[model samples]
Target: MADLPELPATITVDLDTPLKRGDDAIATLTFRRPTTVVLLDMSLIQLGLVDMDVMRDLLTRTSTVGLIGEEVDKIDGADMLQIARDVSDFFQIEEFEDLEIHIDGDIVTIPLVKPIVRGETTLDELRLRRPDSGSFRSLSLARIGQMETRSLAGLLPRISMSPLTEADTYAAEPGKQRGSLHAFLVASICTLARPGAIVDINVAPDRQQWWPGSPLIDLNPHGRTQNKKHRALVPVLPALDRWLRAEYATYIALSQQDRAGRGWLVNYHGRPIQDVDRAWDTMLTNLELPKGREWRSYLLRHSLATLARNRGATKWDLEGFMGHSDGSQTEVYAIGEFPSVVTALEGIVADMERLAPGAMHRSRTEHGLVGQLSKGDENVS
Candidate 1:
């Protein structure tokens, strides 16, 4: 963290060449290190243009290079050495020797000296000192213009799937009311008699029927809706029935207070029974959710479409079930516009009946006779 040393006002350049009176020789001297500024001072004896006092003053003034002085002050010793090496490489100079540096706090002192052999100077050693200047380079206009026409090519289609698992259907301490609701919805869809048929549900009607005066009915009258027109075309496995019923039971039990309190799951003081976000967080912490809502919705729709396709359902039939508008663009332009809960539940029931003839009947019988009566136990500590 030490500050960089400052450059001296001038520098002395030693050359192997001797100069005649009034004869000007430009010596191109290379630096042993990287510096922002380079100073070159002519020897008084060689130039024969000034006295020793002037020459001594010039040498003292040229002792430090100003260009890299600031940078050196800010950087550590290791970085300074590295920068020096880099600068040396840029100059492409070999056999540079007799490098000496003196530092007194922030001030740098450099003394330039050359060997004298029999009072004769070698001309080959004479050179002007030039510091390598680094500056920012801007891109040309032509390159920027060319970039405008560049287009992305060959985008890969992304597909995703999210199947409801046993853990979702039967969590020991159900996380959120929404989670239970979602579980119930998925379960109900699975229980439909038609394995490959589209199931639709309207949240409004279903909520009204399930809990007539609940505040939730007013909040979201539409029952759980589905994209029936977009067929997933996947086969409805038999295991879906049990899963759906379990989810349904859990959802009903959790929302039972809301049902009794005229459709609002909140307490009399209007405080929420549980935080929805916290519930969702719990689910996220325990389960792997689809990346985003669009992806999840697509996965659900795709599953239905795939199932329908496998069941010998025509494109039009699939589209109708999915509530898509009729046209050539049905596959691309058309998406589920109206998701009806009643229609969906009916379809699900029918499918369930087809898959397991006695399952729905037994569930109704058990739920009506015993399930409803024991529901109170759920809210007990």
Candidate 2:
């Protein structure tokens, strides 16, 4: 291990909204580096902010002023995510090396090139066949060696036949069946388990609610749709309508009992899936991505937001679609209330499809979008 930094590293955060605990209202939170015992038990960097419950638990255990669970729960979503990021940064070690390239027969091997740390794995290499004329489809020669993570994620899967499949991700046993559906679900919707639950099957003629995302944080066990404030009908475009129609047919075929009380259109052994961390890792392992490349559902949100903004979405349109509060008392009145949000989303998805084909559907292309968003894939969640 690299040398440890000074003990008790602290991050002082001023909250946009003060949370009340008993007689005291907390306006700022001071987070100290978790104890060695806490770090040993919890992999904050691996878990990151994707798991809000874990972050909350860690904060309660490490706060210098001692916040109760209620106060921690009341913390703003953006602030909480930022704190988790700051905490995770403490675990990063300074490590770098020059990229290595070699040629062997028909394949080219590049090792230890731009190593990245994600969870416990550090991906640092990539092996690919020597590119031919066909490999240059829609890509220039200059872009080949300078491919970003999303490009690599989308490109490599086409070249490689992943061991994991959409069905295998929901297999019954560990050593038995495994697939990429879990990863796909998370990547597609930015939420865990409860697949198809967020979709509105009862489509209206004037408007089609095609929203398939939840809040950046999901701690509700009952489901993410528990809060009425978070519910809104977004207009559906042609592409979204096509995707929804396909999913709707399958959704209606399942018996209510098969939904596992979660109304999940997707399930494993007729049971609702509670988590996908293991399945996500399995999917990553199948992708054969180089070590250190972190994959999280949060990246999907980042991609959508970035693309939507680039497509000229207003801040309210983004805030509405993303289910984020702007610290306005009237923010609750506008969730999914913007008709333009859907238009922005439609454009965003189109941009995604153009950038990374087959992201929306399996038949569309051989490529997958596990990492095929813009450079916004960086951990800003």
Off by over 4 Å in 2: 1-233, 236-244, 254-263, 288-294, 326-341, 355-357, 362-381
After superposition, candidate 1 runs with Cα above 4 Å error: 1-162, 166-285, 288-299, 325-381
Against the reference, the lDDT scores of all candidates come to: 0.31, 0.44
Q: Highest lDDT: which candidate? A: 2
Per-model clash counts, in order, read 68, 12
lDDT of 1 by residue, 127-163 (tens): 1111111100122234323321111000001011112
Cα deviation of 191, candidate 1, in Å: 9.7
